[model samples]
Target: MSDFMEKLRHLIKGGEGCIDHMYLDTVAKVTVGVGNMLPNVAAAQALPFLLRDSGSSASPSEIAQDFESVTEQEPAKVASRYKQYTQLYLPEGAIDDLLDRRIEGFERRLRDDFPDYDGYPESVRLALMDMVFNLGNRGLITKFPSLTRAVRENDWAECAAQCRRRGIADSRNEEVRNLFLMALG
Candidate 1:
């Protein structure tokens, strides 16, 4: 039995600082019909699980957890809440479009922040995006040279190494390594 708010906080930390079901449930109600369609305005929802091999850029369906997958959990509270607040109970895809928009926004923001950054393919984008999402903008600065070198050489292993860290609770971790590997592919 997960408290909605507690789970939502973990989601912000767990899913690369991305929105979760709770986020959507919270925001969806406030949005007018047209406003709901906007990604920034769209709500985040919490799934019961973290994704398997899922990293910073993971989608809701990608979440994997030990105790339960989101698939195992019902959105009874979520659906009812949506109806109560917004007078709408959304179909799944209703939020997917918003997810895509958020990803795009993340990439765009990075590009804008690092205007001098060299060009990169979508894979490079994924690696950096995932890491930044997991950590923060400061992560880019901390791993700047290593991340750049690994991407330039197309070295997934090296990219994983570059993402590595210790001392603080922060780490590149197995999940993040999988993301870099996927990016390499």
Candidate 2:
């Protein structure tokens, strides 16, 4: 991995704790390792889910049953609490691969949106990648106009000022702000 990918992986893992079992996110989305959201049963089935008890691959029906059970539980409950709802787990190697794939997809979207993405400073790239990871491609682009403008202008201070996101922890926001500020030095 590149230095940026390494740092991004560390940051994401720290921010979104790695969970092997399927659980609901803060928004009630079916999520698994590294905050990977499974939008539906089909999406869940695509993953290499294994039976927690037998360590054998889960059948499609089994995966669906577990998914349904988890989704039926109280939404937004603590991630640990949801573990009881599913008998399936994703191996650590599978989780790592999923995270890498997610990062690459987000990076591709970022590159498409920002023609000059590769030319941006490392700090700026990191900050933008972090934001994209949290807010997604459309959310980052359509939701934060000022931040987008600051990025296009290469205005690190303004980017820092405009990067704060609602619902995100203050420390995470601060880290992103600091990344943008790093570009000014």
Candidate 3:
């Protein structure tokens, strides 16, 4: 259900202009999933595009100052808050890790389907890997027919259109759109 949760978060976050976020020291940055270029980007800029239509009441500097002092809230208090929040609000992304093997399953399935296009470009690979990571082997297998056809013919527009047809809402569709756009560039 992790994929489902990811899609749900995408919906909740308004989807557009979405970027992964992380804190680096006292600064914030947009995560490229592997890199961070804008280290000093304000929290207001770095935070994920959640459903908050209102702007920040405090300035970015003020927000950073508050975060700096946040440790004083006490370990137990913080722990309690975490428990309460998790129980009432936050998503629990904990996994079993029971079913994770070498992923020979994916390789076998991909070969059987998209026999051509033995590999993908780095950007395209990132997009495909993300979709597979989120959705798993079975999920990828389900879309084998259309995705395989697109890759075999090297029709990226059709491939992206196929991507848009699958996944919850347009969750994976955005990835396809961005991936093909970058591939063209």
Candidate 4:
């Protein structure tokens, strides 16, 4: 991964640090390892390392069933019942591996779906990747035709403004816009 990609992950994963276990995020998703969202118990199959460290001899299908057994609840409620209800755990490097996979998927989507992505500035690419990391898809960028066009034209200012116009607050949007400007400078 590029330095910019690391920086993007740092910015977005802010204060969360490197998580080494699975838990319920604020919105009730079974978030595991780092920011990997486990949409279903079957999703756990992707992290064999974590499963091995979970200390359970349960097969993948059994683990998926366990994951499915947890009721969808808020973070606090999940935390309260965590010890009694969940058995997910991650050893060192498991979270990193999962994050790497997620990042690779996002990069692939960015390269294949975004026109001229290879030719865009590093900052612009990183910003889009950051957005993809958060949104879990490149479709959000496609929703803003002006932003994509501005990026393709290498119009940093317009791209920044378009980022803000997407209803993101100025403070948060400025950080991303400034990244684009930094590359232009």
Q: Name the best candidate (by lDDT).
A: 2
State candidate 1's TM-score.
0.39
Steric clashes per prediction = 15, 0, 0, 0
Better of 1 and 3 by TM-score: 1
What's the TM-score of every candidate structure? 0.39, 0.92, 0.38, 0.70
> Is candidate 1 or 2 superior in lDDT?
2
* lDDT by candidate, in order shown: 0.43, 0.91, 0.40, 0.64
TM-score of 4: 0.70
For model 2, the superposed segments whose C-alpha errors exceed 4 Å read none
**What lDDT tens digits, residue by residue, belong to model 4 across residues 4-92?**
66776676555234554456766777766556777876677666533444465446765565466554444735333543445555665
Give the Cα-based TM-score of candidate 3 against the true structure. Answer: 0.38
Q: What is the lDDT of residue 182 in candidate 2?
A: 94
Each prediction's Cα RMSD? 14.2, 1.6, 14.9, 4.2
Candidates ranked, most accurate by lDDT first: 2, 4, 1, 3
lDDT for 129 in candidate 3 is: 44
Candidate 3 on 80-157: residue-level lDDT in tens? 232221111111121111112222344456556556434655445444544554455567657556765666776666
Clashes of 3: 0
Per residue, candidate 1 scores C-alpha lDDT tens digits across 1-185 of: 22532332233244433322321223233221212322322122332222223323334433222112222333333322332222112333434444445545655767765663336544445556655654456666665677666665767678777775443234435555665677556
Best by TM-score: 2
